[model samples]
Target: MAPRSSRGKSIRQRGARPPQPRAVSAQDLGKLQGLAGLSLRKLEALRARMRIRQFSRHSTIYKEGDESDDAVYIVLSGIARLVCLNRKGKRNLLEVLGPGDVIEIPSLLPDIHHKLTCETFTDCQIGLISPTALVEGIVGIPFREFNEALNLTVGRWWTLLERHSNFLSQTVREKIMLALLDLGRKFGRRDEHAMIVDLGLSGQDLADLVESSRPKVSECLKSLVAEGVVKREHRRFIIDSVRIQTSLRS
Candidate 1:
């Protein structure tokens, strides 16, 4: 028979060990959406119960239909997207998330499956806390500020759906143009003459975001290129913010 390794022998003797909780800092707490303006003492208390996690780009943090309401995930850094797959298995992009964003506040509530999948758009740092710990952690924040933060968080989804409704009246060209402008503002960096969006997204990803077919999006991109509203160089999009805004106004 093969001899047990020293590590295995030690584990058997010592039994299982619990993972240590990661330390949280005031700066970290300040970045959280609804938890700003918290006192140092409160921040310290919450820090005790939090754990940090890292995920590579394109990783799924939570899947749709997951039954466990284990912990709340907060984005400490990098971008993430909420997506849903329909009955036909068609992908629909819901929202883009960044630092200080929570995956879902409602996940803290009991007896609910995750309705949308949360996937990282870039290499991400995330903070996690149990619902119980979270409840105990935020005991002293001002109710008004906390409530307003919740409203704004929920309001963003409503706004996204509202924009989708508004897009129904717009042409495919107009829709892609609007999508480009929005993404540019969120993810683009300003160069000498344009805002460059370098998300490394493919044509299909953009189509998912714009809620249009790839063929139509390709056609609109050609139109946009011809009109000089947008240009592409090495897979990055160069957007003329001034021109697009002016076109929108006109």
Candidate 2:
């Protein structure tokens, strides 16, 4: 038998990273409640299959032109942005997603890859559910349960195409108005009279969203403020709910 080493061993291994604490709980999956109408009872079987990740602000979760995301990700808390690179390599903002939003419905597809980059806008907790688990978690799962999920994937592309076609025909000012209206509906918080969008978007972000330049977007925003359409306060965009509703309908 070999003799034991005489030197005392260190309990903490040098150059080894510390273990990270789990950032999510089984109880935190309520963020997925709307997707496939998931509930605690529905998630019970998949509990062992799920995982969580904590992301810091401005961290890139995935990049454009990547071959695969391979699984579905749900934002349990905080915000994430979808960005695409233009032909000139400028980053264009596609959308900002908050809690409860799924990264892409196509995550259900085994061979699918992302068309855009996803990144955290703030410190975030993300829930991960693999496609394999989605396939086997429930009885006869893939046959019937995947219908609505697949429909969302088609609908998402339809909406994006529709927006692209509509954008080609819009004036710069018109484009800005529609873009603000879309964001207001998607990310806005409401008080008594106003809708506020505070997704850390700047003029450049809006420009990216609208596929315009910063100067053009800034001019349109200033014009909107002058016309009582949308206002900027404390670096957040604000619009009167009642007023914008009328304007949108007109």
Candidate 3:
């Protein structure tokens, strides 16, 4: 096996950790998808039972082969990337999760070790709920509403699967175009001639997300800029929706 690079400090550090219970709020609980319909009392109860924590940029949330424990996580803000390393030490990005997404739920049932590592791409707040609490809450909730929540969570996973498939099959140019479109649909704002993606991912990071080499990504981006399909700011890309869409079709 290849040796792991010593890049950053261990996630568990000395000194008193921040008080999680006091940090949680009803408003924060409301931001999570499955818990939206939950009452304030319920939220408070859950908060007391869970560990609500904050992590800075590039912090490792969990590592592969770590005990799964009985915990699941909900993103409160910012983004995180799930990644896996192959036997050859090649890194593969599994998915990028934003606020309201849950992590590590599937591993909770069998209580197996984590299969992938989760790392923060930006500063983020997260809530950790014990598997017992989660199961109890689900059992207490109405069957219809629980089913609806399950469906929504499954749909989110399906979207991630489609994105991963696209990254595997598409060329760098096609991937960039599709990424721009997806970002525009999710969080874009309109300009005079284009939709601006406000996500602050760096060029190299974007290349990793699309499973492409940085030089190839840069070449494609430059071509797009020259063709007026995308305009680059310092880090963000402002994409001409019509041109980007047309390029993808062709």
Candidate 4:
């Protein structure tokens, strides 16, 4: 890899690689498919206790410190985001949960409060499950299994927090790279040498994800292109994953 001097890009624009999330499959397509292992009787009980709810884009599901309703929500379709706010009231995108992911699992416990805000980015269908019914469906007679499920739920949030901090503590350029990586891993396709992100993220969208200015993000993208780490093909962004993983590192 050539030095950053040629592109006039700073070293801080580089990102250290993260182990990418698995490419989403049919199981992620929606409709609570992630819980397919439950028995028919259990599922029937869950169905009896849960109801479908819909919300339009940009509608808030709940806010931080909102009282937990002793229930859980499953994303049936569309994007549901978990966001955190700063003291100055700036919104930061903490995590974007798509089809089949549970929303804020820990909040389903009794007497808890939500620490993050949840909202829909597109018109969405969600499954609202009561705590008792959920416990019946997934934790019947197997207390150990319930604990394992709880651990997985917490682990997802833990991973999100780690990545969120990864962005907050990085240089602007690195933050941009990390944001792109996050989006790409969740919504990208690989064909040959390039990984194409298909989320259709605009400059402002990227800016919102990293809490940076769109102009700065544009500059960072320009540097990425000049450094031969990324490219634009039609309307999509295609990144040379190999180079990007080792460009600034190299």
- Which candidate has the highest TM-score of all? 2
Candidate 4 lDDT for residue 138: 50
Q: Which stretches of candidate 3 lie over 4 Å from their true place?
A: 1-22, 32-42, 85-89, 109-114, 138-195, 199-214, 224-229, 239-250
Local lDDT at 103 for model 4: 67
Please provide, for model 3 over 107-215, each residue's C-alpha lDDT reduced to its tens digit, 9 standing for 90 to 100.
Answer: 3433322246787755678888765676566446654455456656664665465355444445668766766776675467897878988788778767755667677
- Candidate 1 backbone collisions, by pair: none
Candidate 4: TM-score?
Answer: 0.61
Q: Which ten residues in a row have the lowest lDDT in candidate 2?
A: 5-14
Candidate with better lDDT, 2 vs 3: 3
The sequence of per-residue lDDT tens digits that candidate 4 reaches over residues 1-250 is 8522322221121132222323223233322545666566555666566676666655666664545444587776666567665444555555666666676454443333324667765556777776556665555645346646766676567656645543443456765665555456556788987789877766666655555677787899889889877787645788776665565354
Residue 200 lDDT in model 4?
Answer: 72
TM-score of 2: 0.62
Provide the TM-score for each candidate, comma-separated: 0.55, 0.62, 0.61, 0.61
Better of 1 and 4 by lDDT: 1
- Estimate the lDDT of model 4: 0.59
**Relative to the true structure, how large is the alpha-carbon lDDT of every model?**
0.64, 0.61, 0.66, 0.59
Lowest lDDT block of 10, candidate 1: 6-15
